[model samples]
Target: MFEQIKVFFMKIWNELIITIIVGFFIRSLKKSKELVKPTINELLNNIDYNSKNWKEEIDKVLEIKTTVERHFPEYKDYLLIQYGSSVIPDNKLPSDYDFIVLLLGYPIEGNRYMHNKGTISDESNETNKDQVDIVFRDYLSFLFAASAGMPYENSVIYNGKLVKGHQGYFQWLKNITKNILFDKDFLIRRFKEKIIAEKQEFHKCLKECEEFGHDEYYVIRAGYYYITSILQLRRIQNFEKVITQNQVIELSKVRSFYEDILDDNIRNKYEQLVENLKRNNTLDLISIDDIKEVLLYIGEEYDKNK
Candidate 1:
């Protein structure tokens, strides 16, 4: 696999860099809980296993099938990537959307559930909001709910949701927001709202970066700045919950707390990405020696921080 990957990128390094950078914006491998969050399994959901609303949600979602055909034509071929239903017993209103959308993986494409990144941070950039995430089998084993039904939008490459216009996308939301789709009929519309909020947060962060004197031209750029900003907020929020100010004695720590959030193998792959960026002058198609210089430069950053 390593040799195959190297050979694959060896042919088109530029495309790889552009992809890694942008792809990371949406497909970031979030560190899942090794042990679930401090919540009792009870805190994890909105309803008990048996609930009347859960049945209602299924009825509502099924009714929206017409909306998809009428609004977005993409589902004309897409399949049921995932079907789940569950209830969050506590009845908390919600901080963000609850549904976790994922595209079916294997070949890794087509109809799939979408990750609600918006709920994670409340920033809804058009591009990020439009992402259609793929899921590995058994990845989120939590999907056995008896009621939730989602129409995973098609994989979006750039200009728009593939084959479906904004109308199709709106149908997707209308179907879910009805709150009649989840097993417990828990409302998951908060994700849509949060995505919008995150985009606003990013604009705020970018403005701060500029007002604080970071050059907007170089300092504030790309979809990544937006993604990283949300990541920062999540870190700050999660850390605040368990660790206090004293715990943050290491003020300059970067990506350390985040290290645990993702598995080592995935994190290591990102490290290799940094190496490739350094070694190959990810900006330029160049010789081996040029890449060597970049590697040395990256090494110095760690050394200086240490």
Candidate 2:
């Protein structure tokens, strides 16, 4: 509860900063920005894109790097994953394929989530229904949050191969999440009533990818979308339960129950990002035009591959 209050204030602080930046011109704006703040904006603007040095941490986790480039190539040059700590310092990069997709996504067709109450305009304690816990949140979702304003870890792609990790590799998108998006005919029938809860929420996650600037964050979070995918094992996890009882209960809901995410510090960061987006008027910054560009890019790429 106290942590929530801290989160509330942090969010406030961030929004204040954004408003100051967007509302008026301050000669000291650049100096006011957080230095070494571990934000995507900082990384993009500061890092030398030509750096040859990168993470050589893991010899096992393979899925990390390839996943980033495939879905989020814009960040291909900057993302990397290290396996152990102490071997490295002050650069505690997240898992190999961090910051891939968007999570805490906006609403979609059906599934709706929680919201915060009691506030004064931007100062309110609003919690978007989409706020899933960080651990259960698909680490990539966490990565996306981190990448929004921090430096994304970097890596190099070699003929579609990684320098190290092999067994740790994984599928691109979650099977369930993908199937929901595939949104076809017979495929829909096969899925039948299997949608336990928050079906629209699935699509919302996809939509969030586009909304959140469709940068390195989307690619990283997309992998964790696979977490939504463990739907295949839902029946067994739930002991032959169907429809997840209500909207909230699910066999895999357990995944979203990680306590690590509830930490005040993490929540503080989440609040800050929300505040920044709101203050910068970056919250819905991606428009219909951006969506069109993305669709066109995807189409052209698809055609070329074919």
Candidate 3:
């Protein structure tokens, strides 16, 4: 009886010990995961936008901003204004957000330069990578981009917030944006240069896509150039005012104004391509042959007009 009692107690103790060990292990694992995750404030405060290359900079900004806006809703108030597809209300698609941001009391007084404070990553959702570009600028840098006739400045002047605050600083930025963007000669020269650049980019992306396989990256870029070239060509031809990408797509869908000049088949293709780009965030579904043919048509039209 004594021996049996001892064995029973020993068995109970063994099971208890095993349970305690497993519990401890799980607790440690939970702690480690908590430590690995970054705080919301840390993520928001760490955005870096110092790249001089506008294309590369915008790419990074969009990737970072998507995560920021979804995870943190408070930051939307801080957003000055959004350009691009977000400016369109009825056109609901998973489009990138291109906007300006105001981060108060940053970079410090003496060390007041666009330097990063920390870093952020989106390990949670790897598949659907929503991207939007955010520009964090001080007064002088904003003025510089406005005065310098950079391509993106046109978007801001048209869509960005035009309010007065911080000692009428916002108004100052607005005035500068208008002064530079609205000049007749400046628009003419800028549109002409933009046309050439877009053509080159469209061909370059198309060639790479053909040489390499049909990659989503190259297709997206090609689609961008394709639509932008059409819009710029129309603008230059008619001496029309500036319009956003969404505006151009809208006009194309109805075969209105400049878009009415497109061949019925070309107009249909343009409509299909733009819709696919908007819905899937890529031009993967569109056929390469179709793309080439449409591009050829666009080139012919441009040549005739030019």
Alpha-carbon runs more than 4 Å astray in model 2: 1-38, 55-98, 101-186, 190-196, 199-281, 284-306
- Local distance difference test, each candidate: 0.31, 0.30, 0.51
The alpha-carbon root-mean-square deviation between model 1 and the true structure, to one decimal in Å, is: 25.6
Candidate topping lDDT: 3
Question: Which stretches of candidate 3 lie above 4 Å from their native place?
Answer: 1-81, 84-152, 161-172, 179-186, 212-214, 240-258, 280-282
Tens digit of per-residue lDDT, candidate 2, span 20-114: 88766664665566442433322322434255533232211222345433533433232222212212346453311212222233333322222
Candidate 1 structure, TM-score to reference = 0.20
The prediction achieving the highest TM-score against the true structure is 3
TM-score of each model, paired residue for residue:
0.20, 0.22, 0.49
**Poorly placed runs, candidate 1 (over 4 Å):** 1-67, 70-72, 76-96, 102-306
Instruction: Count the clashes in each prediction.
Output: 35, 30, 2
The sequence of per-residue lDDT tens digits that candidate 1 reaches over residues 1-306 is: 999999888879988888889877655444344434432112323433276465334323322234334533343322222211122235343222113222222322432322222112111122221121122221122132111222221111111122212345334533433333222112123223333455565456556665785423221222222333333334343343233222222322323534633545434433443332222223223322332333234324323532
Candidate 3 matches the true fold with a TM-score of 0.49
